[model samples]
Target: MTGISYRRPSSYSRLIGVGGARGDRIVPNGDLAEALERDDEWIRRRTGIITRRHASREVLVQHLAEQAARAALDASGVPAGEMDVIIVSTVTWMKMTPGLAPLLGARVGASPSAAAYDVNAGCAGFCYAIAQADAMIRSGLARHALVVGAEKLVDFTDPTERTISFILGDGAGAVVLGPSDTPGVGPTVWGSDGRKGDAIRTTHDWLEYKYADDFRDVPWPTAEQDGPTIFRWATSVAPHFAAQAIEAAGLTPADIDVFIPHQANLRIVETMAHTLGLREDAVIARDVIDTGNTSGASVPLAMERLLREGTVHGGQTALLFGFGAGLCYASQVVELPDAVGGDGEYHADAPTAMSESEEIGAGE
Candidate 1:
């Protein structure tokens, strides 16, 4: 029998462009203060969040994802038609069928044949997706891929719930990956602690909520978490994983120019940074202060903010890590993208010229 042939793999993969999109509504602590019966100062002291974005009911998850994806594609100068894969990592898509990836691909004008799918690894989703995209490119499954982390946590957050409601926000961030001559995305260090999965999760599953005899009394499935438990786990585990990622990349704390961890909480970010003992000049993302905790979208959002603010530049070495929910986490070292697209403004009323078929296909 003749030997089977395989597609030629690329030497490596690297992020080519980056983009971010946030909801239009700016929700301040005062807006949620009455519901939580907590003052803005108290909330600020605890979470370091002054404001967060919450998309209006009319603004669907796909809109944010599309906006981010467009910006990334424009920045990369890689037309959507060239994309071979598109991955969306989100937990609050609110639907079980017709995944967000395909819809986003259609809306963004990616070739219909592109492999599209969704990933739900909780807050670590973006890093997980990036790792997958990198592997796909290196394995010759794809040459150019778009990886997006978008979420509408507001839809699943209960204002009356104090554990994580105020910390939740809605937004999306994305990156374009393509083949590179050398390693631009380093080895990923990832793992999950299923034993502590309950540290952060929804209050109940769909089945429980659907079967409840007292419909009104039964709370809707909403995000909830053991704050203290997650704090301890993240601070302790993040440092180790971050070091492993750096070491895997054949670098050290001194070599990392930026540190973008999951924007879950300011305290967690600070604790992990302190524990890691990175160089004093290393820039740590504090996007959580303004963006709140956007779950899966946090890592890329933080990285985008750093780039937009001119704090970190292209070719700079950075360590990106994310952890939450499923008690899962992923970290990797990467060379920052050279350019970013999109004005970082989300126009809810912006019109699109998508063909009728594309609109219908995207389920818009």
Candidate 2:
């Protein structure tokens, strides 16, 4: 090993800004009901999702990521040239090599020598990226970093698979980190159970299809999930991790101003909230009702929404938890940024206003 070593100072990194972007197409439950023969009420009762955004054939994951990154760069007032590190959390990238970070860095005009890469930890990806970014900053390897969680889950979805079809959506969210005198992000609590990896998954290995006689004829592997298994894991086990994150942050649950768990389901969020025993005035993100489950993008998307919508203000402490696929889980507490976008509103045309029929019929 090279003998070069460095020690971190007492200072910590802070999330200085935030931003989020969703696809143009809005898909409501009515559209899914027509195809699956399930009523809108049934879906709402089951998953608390009334609508979600699905990108058109023209929209790629890169497009959504870049939009959010630009907004974040503007919000932070930190030029892309000043960033020394970039990390993207994703699992829905179509292109496996070259990674999403380099492309995002190029789009945002990051420094030529910046360390950029992508990480895959399913829906827990955002939290994992945050944890790694915090460590890098604390270790003095990076001074400022941009962490993004983005997904194009629709590409892996089959509308006929009613369970996952109505739940998955497309979107991206981002945050900028910078050095601070005090801790802006707390210690992270993370763990995984690989044995339960089959609970939620997609099979897209090239090796499995490399020898196929006709690759075009192959049916793309769609996403699948054991809903009950995941629900039990999230509701029963995630609360413990959430508490650990709070403790690691040198705070108590009662001190938290907001609780932003992964936008997976309303029931899970409620259960976690109750288990944590947070103050009654605490804000909890319920973006899943409209944004659906954006997987890796859920946490940051919810965070940006909370900030942009004025539900939670800057400097308040918030607890963020992300868990799913690979049975992976991660949680941390952070101080909210003062602003979400360079402008007051990040997405001026957010949620894409659409007529009832057009919005619901987007799936067609």
Candidate 3:
């Protein structure tokens, strides 16, 4: 057998915020205010989700994306203007004209030349984006990379689709990536079974599937889902793929300091942690009591929460896994350094600008 080695980091992204939104969305409950036909207890037992916050579709996706980017930029000390690339990882992007990155750049004041775009691999969008950023950095094609995961699924799911509606919320999470020779996060792993891609889809109408519009044609504005099947899929594949990633990093399940599985459902989370033989007391869990499944935003949002509270302190290992929609999946291990700030670490909502500088370059 070969030896197992670990590469620890001295610093890491200082995570902050669940987009610092204005107010919390109400969780569906029995006889509670705006409770769906389904009661809270019933909803919780089945999906392990008691509540989730839905973003106002009226608010532009760029606003939430920029807010999260500001938080990551502030925490990482990376300037937005210097950012070489901005990847807005989401399936629910705004209108087709500007795409996500350009709009995000305008919102945050980044260099006009910075490359930006969007992607869709369902909830695995961030993981897909992470791999893209890593490859670009490793290949010397890019320097500072800003990764943001934002979703507004509530915009798509009408109230009738309770199976899908109550389970999703809207928010964004961001991280700044730079070239680093120093071992930082982990060598990530990506896997997919497109064979089941159609099992979960965002549109049912042929016109919708084609992503056509009245004036022109746009894709990915809204989404449709098959919730029950996807839930079963999450319970099964997420942990196994996460294990594959940990093993690739030369670490055992026990070595992981925290499990930041995507904040889709509590039952899946509870099951996956158990299957992986990890502790249930989470160092990095989505404060999902109300924010339900932000899909693409789940993992990074959880990372923000954990880092903000020092739940995942300096010098600990975290494993993050995400899977959904495309039947797509991804997992990775991250080493956390101190997120030391004066007033402890962070607050749920912040008032001023983020602390990241205006320049960008990978610091490996």
Q: Of the candidates shown, which would achieve the greatest lDDT relative to the real structure?
A: 1
lDDT of 3 by residue, 175-256 (tens): 7776555555677788888877876676545466455555245433345566667767777766778888999888888788
How high is the CA lDDT of each candidate model? 0.89, 0.86, 0.67
By descending TM-score, how would the candidates be arranged?
1, 2, 3
Q: Where does model 3 exceed 4 Å of error?
A: 1-24, 27-36, 206-224, 279-286, 337-364
Superposed by TM-score, candidate 2 places the C-alpha of residue 120 at a distance from the truth, in angstroms, of 0.4
lDDT measured at residue 190 in model 2 versus the true structure, 0 to 100: 97
lDDT of 2 at 341: 75
lDDT of 1 by residue, 102-182 (tens): 888888888899999999999999999999999999999999999999998888989999899999988999999999999
1-364: candidate 2 lDDT, tens digit per residue? 6896676643788899898888678899999887788899999998988899887765668767877887888899999988889999999777768888987897788888999999999999999999988888887888889999989888898887865778988999999998888999999999999999998987565665787898886778889888898888888888999999999999998999999999888888999999999999999999898888999999988989888888889999999999998989999999998878733222434432223422222345
Write down the lDDT that model 3 would get: 0.67
Name the candidate that leads on TM-score: 1
Error of 2 at 100 (Å): 0.7
Candidate 1, 314: how far from true, in Å?
A: 0.8
- In angstroms, the error of model 3 at 361 is 35
